[model samples]
Target chain A: MLTKRIIPCLDVKEGRTVKGVNFENIRDAGDPVELGSFYAQQGADELVFLDITATNEKRKTLRELVSRVARHINIPFTVGGGISSVEDVVALLQNGADKISVNTSAFKSPQLINELAKEFGSQCVVLAIDTRQEADGNWYVYLNGGRVKTEADCFRWAKEGVDRGAGEILLTSMNHDGTKKGFAVDITLQLASLSVPVIASGGGGTMEHFTDVFRQGKADAALAASIFHYKEIGIPALKQYLQQQGIVVRWESNENFIC
Target chain B: MNIVIIKYNAGNVQSVLYALERMGIAATVTDDHEKIRSADKVIFPGVGEASTAMQYLRERKLDQVLKDLHRPVLGICLGMQLMCAYSEENNTACIGIFEEKVRHFSAAHADVGQPAGEEPLKVPQIGWNNIFHLKTPLFRGVHENSYIYLVHSYYAALGEHTIATAHYGLDFSAALHKENFYGVQFHPEKSAAAGAQVIRNFIELVPAI
Candidate 1:
């Protein structure tokens, strides 16, 4: 069963929607193609934009705001800050973007994650780690966005970005980024114990912190940004409070509710 | 209903051409062989790497025009593992139009969510699971287990053109018909609203074929 995903990460700056508390103080959270088609009509199984103004004229308006949020959203979205090669992931997957997260040229050239998983393959490559924990618990690895710091070992560069192919692993936690006081559940269970698919990202505010980052950070996905950009929380009441706390999310329609 | 999304080199055909422009249906990604042989409906979406996507679908022969398309060809997710017939990932050879094979959910013996030392069930079986055994009409109104949106690492196992099924650590083949050729190891354009009612029941089966 693959349910536990409820992502919301929008970040984009200069074009719109922005949130940053521990990452700074930037605010304004709106209009990323209407808060990403209002979190894909509020079910939000996926969506992560983050192009914090990688300027070349705000990178052509974040590829026209990811082609108008992939033409007013259907679902599966992802696009990260200044992607850095494979023609910026084929211009944001030809202006639509399904997935393509790469943190700072993948830790400054880990062969740009095998040249974007050898040109868009490793399930459309995403290796967005941004750790930072130390004080003896050690986690280190942050780049351009988290503003540099790299001894590398954030579970050995996420097992060498999942051994150079990187199917997925968004993992944020710059000491619980934006500090809402929740996720980073022990390094998102140490990058979900490194098997692969682990999208935990920062301190999500509540909804029992996305059911403790998916039942104690076993996180197969649980990203957030200011608890869904200032609405504080409301991805259909946090997937109806993580489906009344069972946590198998992706719930919009009590029966076909798409819009 | 001209649709047409088979453009080879994988990677989610721009989210299945924005899930057919969010059902307003303005598709056409194209690999060209006569615009996908006079398309009436032909998705074959993907997310890549099956021996360089069958060497870019045999360098554009689009694998014999998607094995002589007579129309109605769904195929999402590595375009339903490159329309089966062989793919141990790089072991290649596909487009047999569903005789099945595509293994590697750790050899498909699958105990469903493997235990005895976790962390093994992650060979790309990516997001939203649960497709249950739903037999054809491309899952019309799709229910049984309903949760779609998959992202592979090679599957397809349960053959005889598996109508639909999904178990992650193993049950396999979540949707793969034969006749008018359809296939969906999930991602009915990122599964939401029961994957947009299986893309409006595959665009109302392109006006009932």
Candidate 2:
């Protein structure tokens, strides 16, 4: 049976992982590559590197960080944030990024999804949709790191993205992102109707939240950041908990560290 | 050791290069005919549309080079698909190194994700799954049920050349071997320890040419 994946998200700034990540044993705690290695050692099924470094020099640092992380870890990882063109996707894929996530650019040009999926195959293209529930109780698309709102509805955009050749959907609820209350199972379950594997992101608070996203949300994978970074939850422990609860997951033990 | 990874328009070549770097072996990723043929060990790794990838190889005259390689050749993912005779993907004619055909998963088995007498058809069998019925030196140190990463919409039907089989919609060749030529549908480079073992085994298979 194919096990549900537990992915840890890392925010990279200026080529290093942001603050508050458990870094006791790492020689250079700031390095994103080092953090990737640590998570790989802890049995993270896959890792997501979000380059949030807001600078004119974002390209050089993020590319270097991806290269370093690629050289250090063997597991697959996705690079997201500020990816606007096919050139950017090519550059990142050349740097050893298994997949590239597109959000704002994808919305700006829906045809970009078809172009990318045509050139690189759908498996390599992930449509990262950032959605937030408004006062009308209907989820709306947000762009520019959740600052700009778009008229596109979440469900319709996700369906159109898939039809445009997106193999996976990384749906994140902005309202639930920093809250950590729980995954937006309502939206996730609705998004799953698209039939291309949905990666439920944002508001992954506890182990129960993960199981809920998998069982009720019907998410093929769950991605979280702060929970895994703050040491409040360890990947190995969470996977074990899911396993005990009859949720299929891949868990590599300490003695068999691949790194 | 001169490890040459055949580089063309195919995607995911960088991951293979980095995998070798981690193994402490500097590998040259190139499409040079002489470089690919002369290298002691050749790794043909690919990711992309089969027809487009094969078209790129044909234009580069690599079609003949890959077919005539005398040394140990390892093909991963789409590289394995191209080693076959034909692929349903874009109806492409391949190098015929494996004497098999690549095909998209059957959608006949509907009601895929429910508990029924039949299983739903899942294409591109992404993520990690275990490979069993192992044979050949490629899987020497790999455990029978150990998981490896795979991401493909087409698969080569089981044949005499099959070295390992993995299940999704149905059992297909996870790894296939015919003489010096080896093909793995899964990405050993991205498959962690068990996958590392497979790469290590392939590198150690020959007694220095």
Candidate 3:
């Protein structure tokens, strides 16, 4: 059986990953290569590098950064940010990224998912959703890094993404992000109806938070940024905790730990 | 010595690379014929849809190179599927090393009410399945019915190359071995200790040049 994965996401800007509160007022974490290598060593199943900057001219920089990270990290890496066309996805894949995430572009043209999946297999395409809970309890999916709201319903878009050929769905809860309260279990469970694997992002404060998403949210993977970046919950310890909970994680002997 | 991982737009190469790193063996991923042909060992790991994967291999003329490899070659998941004669996945023709056709597990077995003769199993057979009935050095010290991680909907029925077997909707080929070529449906990289031991065994089996 495929065990649920634990992934750590890094927000990259101008070649460096930025981690901050509420996706604003960011602080430099470290070099992307170093952080990626650290997470790979710590037992992260996969790493996602989201280029936070919204621009058209920075694709080359993102590509260079991806190549650098690929040189050092051995695990699967997904790159997103400012991806508009199939060319963007190809460029990222050519540079060493295992998958490309499309958010705003997919919303602009839902057919993009189908097209990309047809051209480069569904497993290579990941649909990233930035969702916020409306006051009325309806979750509205946003784009452009949660800056703009789309009329497309969150659940509808998720199913559409899978229908269009997204191998995985990365749903980020804007409401619980950086708050440490917990993941949006209801939303996660709602999205779980689709066959594609779901990766829950945002709102992770502790190791218990991860366990909660796996147990309660029913997510295939739980991704947290600051917690892993700040050395708060190293991946090995987290795996131990999950294993104790009967999650059945693949444990590796940490021979590199020179202690 | 570097292990050459064929990069024909297949998924799970990263997983194989990480698995090798876990065993402290460094490898280089490449699609170039010269690089792959000269390497100590060649790994063709795959995931995702098969038709397009075969298309990519054909486009790069890698199918011929893969068939001609004299050194040890290891294929995992979709990689194993591609090594077969043909796949029902999009009805794609493959490298044809193994004379077997890949078929989707039908729900007929799962819907049945009989205790032994049950209904058809579900599609996209996901999660941890067990692999048993091993042959040769691949299973080396691996225990029978050892639980391994799997995430595929289609499976290769028993054929001339089947090295091991597993049951989901029914008994299916779990691993394949043919001379210098080998294939395992489970993701060795993600299979924990059993998976790592398999990888280590593959590394150890690479014939010295």
Candidate 4:
């Protein structure tokens, strides 16, 4: 059976982890490689490193960080933030990134999705959609780190992205972000109706939120940042809890054997 | 052992190289016939569309080169799919090393009914899942129901050559072995500890030839 994925997201800036991680015994919390390997050791199904750096050397820094992370961590990881061209994706993949996420560039020129899907298979292309529900009770797509809003409907744009050859959708609800209340079940459920797998992001406060997203929202995966970074919820315990709830997750007992 | 990873137009092979390096083994990535034929072990790693990859191999004559090699050759993901006789993806003919046909998961799921209220199986399964019924030296130390990562929309049908199986909507070949050739549908390179063990087992296998 294909199990629901639990992912730990890291925000990287200038080749270092941006958010303060609370993992004990970690020599350098700023080191993405060490932190990524630590998360893999904790049985994180996958990792997503979002490069939040805005500089001329951002690409070089990310490439170095990606290769360093790949050399240490064995599980698959995705790299995102400011990835617009095929060359950028090529550099990252060549350095060992399993997948790449695109947002603003993809929205500005939707053809970029087709080009990436053509060059590399669709499986490696992840469409990251940032959206927010407005006064009209409709979700609108937002871009540039949720600062700019577009007239495009979230559901329609998601469907269009899928049709254009995005294999997965990372839907982050701006409304629910940092609220720690719960996932945006309504919009997530709608996006999950599409043929592609939907990764529900933002508003994950507790393990029950994960259960609700998987059971009710029908999300194929759930991604959270602070909850994991601050050690508020350990992945092993969360997996056990979800397992007890009858949700199938990839839980292995051989923690000591992880290489 | 001199290991060579057969490189083509397929997706990145750097992860595979990095995985082997973790095992303290350095491998060369090349397409030269002599290098692949002369190596003690050869790994064919791929991550791309079937027909296009097969076309590249055919054009480069790597298909024939691969078939003629007697050394232990292991294929991963699309590399495994291309070892089959035919693929439903883009209606392409494969290398015919394995008699089974590569099939799209959706077409295979049609006969199997989904449990009530369950979400339809997503295409291109993109996460960790367990592999069971291990029967090959490739999985010698790996336990039954060991989880491995996978990402694909198509799968190779279970057949006589199947050494292991996994279930998505139905049971399909997780690993296949025949004589000197071996193939696995999952990306062992990206599958963490258990995956590293599988790669180690393959490296330690005694070539039947």
Candidate 5:
């Protein structure tokens, strides 16, 4: 059995880490390099850094930050935000980002995914989709920091993203964002129908929520921030709970614990 | 001495670097012929479509450089596949270091139980699987039925050079070992500390020069 992944997402703005409620009301978190090391030490499977600053100059700074973090952390890290060109993707990868996530750029020009995949290989490109449910109960895609609404169906875009050579889909639920209720199971199930691996994000309150997303929602991985950042749950204990529930995890050596 | 990782559009090189650091060895990533040739050990790791990956290697002239290296070299996943004579992935030719052909797992096994004549198994066999029939140096201190992580759609069928075996729809080659060149289908770096130990074995095998 393959082990399920537990991930923590950090939104980076002006070199500082921030967590927003429903992708708004950003509060100061801490320095990304320091927080990244902390999460890696606590046994995070992967870390995601979203550069929410939305400026060209900040872009350069973000790449440097990625390089600094990669110096110490031994786990995979993903960088997103204001990425509009292939050069941007290349810069991040060269600066130590294992994977690059594209949301707004992916929607603005669909060919961006195919082009980037062709240049950097599909496994290095991640299509991050942010979706919100409409009055008709259909999930509509949102872009540009979730300020623009598109007619693209969430499921359709996911299938298309994978078809365009996206190695993985980072599906975040705007409705569930910062709610702490749970993940969007319906959306997750729909995306999973495409045969491409999907990571469920938004609305993770507790460890049980994670297990539910894995078992009921059928997500390949779960990404959360407040839960891990606020010390509400530790990764080791969470893994223990998931293991008890019959979820396979890559367990580290307790006997080999260094210091 | 910095261990040089040959970066030719391969996957998991970063993870391999992290895995090396976890074991107290620092490595530098490079595709430069001189830098890689001068390193104590070189690792070639990859994931993704094979034909395109080979194209990238050839475009950078890494194909020729890899063949001429006298240092200890380890290839993982698609890295192992590229070391073969040829690959069925997109009907691509590869470095003929190992006389093997990478072939997709036949769908014939899916119909094993069906009326005596139907493709029975699935392609792109993903997830955790067990490997056995190990050789001395790589499988050293590891059990025969030790489980390893795998996420490949195609596999190198068992041949004279196979070092280990695993069953998907049937028994297939999980690893290949030849003179000076070692390869494994499963990622030892991503396989946890046990996997990390295999890397340690490879590091220890580095001729102490």
Candidate 6:
């Protein structure tokens, strides 16, 4: 049985974690490697490091961070943000990143998805779609960190991405992102119909929300940032809660063994 | 022990190297025939299409080098599939270490008894899944039904070489063992602790005489 995945995403800038990660025991909250290993220790199935660095040296910084994370963390991790070309992906993968997520670049040039899927296997390419529901009640794809909206319908675009050989879809809803209400179950449910696995992101405020996404929305995995970084929800407790809710998750009996 | 990872045109060998480093084992990633043939244990790791990889291996005659190894050889993911006799992927012929055929996952949902309105088993079968019926020394300390991470669309059909099994719509070979060759469908490097344990077990295995 394939267990539902729980992922904690971290935003990185200049090789340092940018978000406020409120962990008391952590010595350096700014270190992406430390935070990533911390999450892996806490039973995070996987980690995603979105390199938000917008400078000329972003690639070098991200590569170094990726190498450090791979050296320390035992589980799989994906590196995204500012990944535009095959060279960028090769650099990251060579540095030990498992997968690379492409959003704006992929939307800008949909062939980028095909080229990546060809160069690396589809398993290594993750198509992240940032979408928002408009007044027309139709979800539209958003680009450039959710600021610019495109004419691409979320559902149709997702299918096109999948057809282009994207092995996984990371669907993040802009409207519900920070609202703390719940995940965008409606669009997520529709996107789950695609052949590839769908990872629902944004708007995960509670453990029940995770259950809803996996159960009702049929998401194979759910990704969140702040709720986990702030210590509001511990991964062990969340896994336990999901287990009680009859969701199958990978449970590590000896959590400290990895340490 | 002199450990060498046979490198052709595959991805994710870096993670395998890091995993070995965690166990304090320094492994050499090389396609050089001398290094691989001289190493006490050889690891064949891959993540790519079958025909293309096989073509690369054949072009360099690494296929013959791999087939000629007398010591223990371990294959991961695409490496495992390529160890089989044949693969439906691009209708490619693979090394004959394991006498099974690798078949692609079909979207047919009725066979799995998936109720209508339920999502069919996703291709690539990403995330963690348990392996059971462990038989070989490869899985010595690993617990049965221990979840291991996997991401692939094709699987080797269960046969005499199967030492472990996992289900995703049907029972398939999770791990296979022959005279001196071992192949696992999962990425032991990225599977966390239990996966690490599998790697440890492989490292500790005495090379077959």
Q: When superposed on Cα atoms, how far off is each prediction in RMSD? A: 19.8, 3.7, 4.7, 3.2, 4.2, 3.2
The residue-by-residue lDDT of candidate 2 on A1-259, one tens digit each, is 5778888888776666663212112222256777788888787888898775432233432676788888888899898888877888888988889998888878989999999998889999999988989999999998766667898899999999999999899988887885678999999999877757889988887889999999999888999877777777899899999988998787645334233
TM-score of 3: 0.81
Model 1 TM-score (B-chain only):
0.35
Worst 10 residues of 1 chain A by lDDT: A52-61
Q: Write the per-residue lDDT of candidate 4 for residues B84-190, one digit (tens) a residue.
A: 99999999999999999999999888878887876688898888899999997898778889899999999999999999999999999999999999999999998
Model 1: clashing residue pairs? B164-B175
Of 3 and 5, which scores higher on TM-score?
A: 5
Docking class of 2: medium
Give candidate 4's whole-model lDDT. 0.88
Candidate 2: list runs displaced more than 4 Å.
A19-30, A53-61, A252-259, B106-122, B206-209
Task: Report the number of backbone clashes for model 1.
Answer: 1
TM-score, A chain, model 2: 0.90
Instruction: Go through the candidates in order and give each one's DockQ.
Output: 0.27, 0.58, 0.24, 0.76, 0.26, 0.70
Model 3 misses residue B129 by how many Å?
A: 7.7
Model 3 segments more than 4 A misplaced: A55-61, A252-259, B1-41, B45-49, B52-70, B105-152, B158-174, B186-204
Q: What is candidate 5's lDDT per residue for A1-259, written digit by digit as tens?
A: 3457788888888888888888899788788888888887776777888887663343543778887877566556778888878898777776768678988878888899999878776657779999999999999999876778899999999989988978778999999988899999889977866655678999999889999898888887789987877778888888888988998765443525222
Per-residue accuracy of model 5 over B116-180 as CA lDDT, tens digit each: 45223323454356678887476666666665667676788789999889887667788887777
CA shift at B133, candidate 1, in angstroms? 31
Candidate 3, residue B136: the lDDT equals 73
* Native contacts kept (model 1): 0.74
How big an interface RMSD has model 1?
8.5
Number of the top TM-score candidate: 4
Q: Output the number of the DockQ-best candidate.
A: 4
Give the Cα error of residue B181 in candidate 2, in Å: 0.8
Q: Which stretches of candidate 4 lie over 4 Å from their true place?
A: A19-29, A54-61, A254-259, B206-208
What stretches of model 1 exceed 4 Å from their correct place? A1-109, A128-130, A133-139, A142-169, A177-180, A183-202, A208-221, A224-236, A239-254, A257-259, B1-43, B48-55, B58-60, B63-68, B75-186, B207-209
Query: Model 4 chain A, poorest ten-residue lDDT window?
Result: A20-29
Where model 5 places Cα greater than 4 Å from the true spot, the runs are A55-61, A252-259, B7-39, B55-65, B104-153, B157-175, B186-196, B206-209
Q: Per model, how much of the real contact set is kept?
A: 0.74, 0.56, 0.09, 0.79, 0.06, 0.73
